[model samples]
Target: SQTIHQWPATLVQPVGSPLSLECTVEGTSNPNLYWYRQAAGRGLQLLFYSVGIGQISSEVPQNLSASRPQDRQFILSSKKLLLSDSGFYLCAWSGLADTQYFGPGTRLTVL
Candidate 1:
């Protein structure tokens, strides 16, 4: 069975600070990795995705970046975060053999 792991569950940060979030998968190889954000009442927005190691695609250009160094490890990072960066972040994965599985997610608050 495939599963995803995300941490912190919640976060509070000041504007202009740095940000780093991690996600990892189990029970699959070369699964498509994704980073998404959902606002208070907004739908999920894809921030980034990775098809393979060292290959990342940015869906929306903003203050975030993503990377996949290992077969199952994905990371989202920002050098200088903004107040608009506050939201619920989710890590997800989907393989051609399976449907997308989302993690518990992290609620980020930027003040």
Candidate 2:
């Protein structure tokens, strides 16, 4: 029974502040992890992904970065966030079949 967890389900931050979002999976190992962002009424945009620990791939070059510090742990961070960075952040894990199972997303608002 694999399950994904994300923290601080909703956040409101000032512009130019730092951001840190974490995602971890239970009951799985070496799963392909991904980070996605969706603006209000927009489609999900792939941000980053990892096939294994310490192996991260960026799909979009933006103000954000991701790291896999452990087998089932993924972290998304930003040194300074932009107003455009506010959105719904989703963390997902996929198996060999490539069907992504998402965690409850984190909603961010920048003011």
Candidate 3:
């Protein structure tokens, strides 16, 4: 019974501010974790992924970064926000298969 959860469901921030988003999974161990972003009417873009704790791979070079502090916790952060950074942020987990289960996501708006 693995479940994923993301915080703050929605966020609104001004440009140049700092941002922090968190995700956590329950009932799982050593799962592959991922972070993604989806713009308005656009497809998902993988931002970062982790195969294990402290082992992260960045898929897209952007203004964001991710960290795995615990076995089931992932955190996404930005030093400074930008208007273009506004989008739907998603956290996902997968086993050995190709199927990925995603969280509800966090909608971010930059103004």
Candidate 4:
């Protein structure tokens, strides 16, 4: 029974602030980890993914970055956020090619 946890379910930040969101999985090992951002009416866009420790693949480049330091811990960071950076941040995990489970997601709004 693997599960993921994401913090600060919602956040409000200024135009130029640092951001950090963490996600972790329990009851699984070496699972595929991914970070995605979804706008109001768009599809799920992959930001980053990791197959193993220190092995990451970036699907899209932006002000955000992802790191997988441990087997089950992933961190999303930003040195300075932008107005376009505001959206729904989702952390997901998959053991195979066809299925993935998403977290509750973080709604970030910048002013």
The lDDT for every candidate, in the order shown, is 0.92, 0.95, 0.96, 0.91
Residues 72-106, candidate 2, lDDT per residue (tens digit)? 99999998989999999999999888799999999
Candidate 3 residue-wise lDDT at 57: 97
Predicted candidate 1 versus true structure: per-residue lDDT over 1-111, tens digit per residue: 888999778999998899989999999888999999999998999999888999999999899999898989999999998999999999999999567789999999999
After superposition, the stretches of candidate 4 with alpha carbons farther than 4 Å from their true spots are none
Off by over 4 Å in 3: none
Q: Cα RMSDs of all predictions?
A: 1.1, 0.6, 0.7, 1.0
Residue 76, model 4: lDDT of: 92
lDDT of each residue in 1-111, candidate 4, tens digit only? 989999779999998899999999888888999999999888999999999999989998789988999999889989999999999999999986759989889999988
lDDT tens string, model 3, 5-91?
999899999999999999999988999999999999999999999999999999988899999999899999999999999999999
Candidate 4: count of backbone clashes, pairs at least 3 residues apart or interchain: 0
Clashes per candidate (backbone, < 3 Å): 0, 0, 0, 0
RMSD of 4: 1.0
The TM-scores, one per candidate, come to 0.95, 0.98, 0.97, 0.95
Flag clash pairs in model 2: none
Worst 10 residues of 4 by lDDT: 95-104
lDDT (C-alpha) at residue 68 in model 4: 93
Clashing pairs in 3: none
